[model samples]
Target: GAGVSQTPSNKVTEKGKYVELRCDPISGHTALYWYRQSLGQGPEFLIYFQGTGAADDSGLPNDRFFAVRPEGSVSTLKIQRTERGDSAVYLCASSSRGWRTDTQYFGPGTRLTVL
Candidate 1:
């Protein structure tokens, strides 16, 4: 019955460093999604995973962003060469069953600060 969770809650890094954020989806959920929210903006989908494979990764902004869900439950979002523009709250969500469901319960989010 555990909800999705993201680690660090907050992260601070230099403009060119690498950072990894973790997400633990709820038990029994088959769909997981990653979204990024900048200041005063709606969350934008980054990537999504159905079971252990990525169902949609078109939202990834560039080569600097990537994610994986190997075991079909826990996932990690990795960013390389982090830029100042990358500073934002990275949110993770999960839902029951499959892709048609839009009810993605969210975590408190991991706030990334790039300087």
Candidate 2:
């Protein structure tokens, strides 16, 4: 693909429901990251995956949030017991090298609406 692609571009669910957001990074990208953007706020980094392992996950608010990059190319963000506060635009990004300082191409994002 020419850029990162996220599945289910939009989602609406009631509180307490579970949701999964998928991200497919550009081929050959070695670093993948996940972020969440709420209305009127900038995107907040949630997790960073280098290759097949998570490099940083401290940005996850709580146990209800998690992400995985099992094969290094595709990643998934999982949410359990979704809350109205959890509604946000989940963005995925990828970089070819130097994750800390390299340019990261962002996806369109998955809009999750928790009612």
**Model 1, total clashes:** 0
TM-scores of all models?
0.96, 0.96
Local accuracy of candidate 2 as per-residue lDDT tens digits, 1-115: 5999999999999999999999999999999999999998999999999999998999999999989999889999999999999999999999997356899999999999999
Query: By lDDT, who's the top model here?
Result: 2
Residue 76 displacement (Å), model 1: 0.2
- What's model 1's TM-score? 0.96
Where's the lowest-lDDT run of ten residues in candidate 1? 96-105
Q: Against the true structure, candidate 2 has what lDDT?
A: 0.94
lDDT of 1 at 42: 98
Please state the error at residue 15 of candidate 2 in Å: 0.8
lDDT of 1 by residue, 23-114 (tens): 99888889999999999999999998999999899999999999999999999999999999999999999998765746888988999999
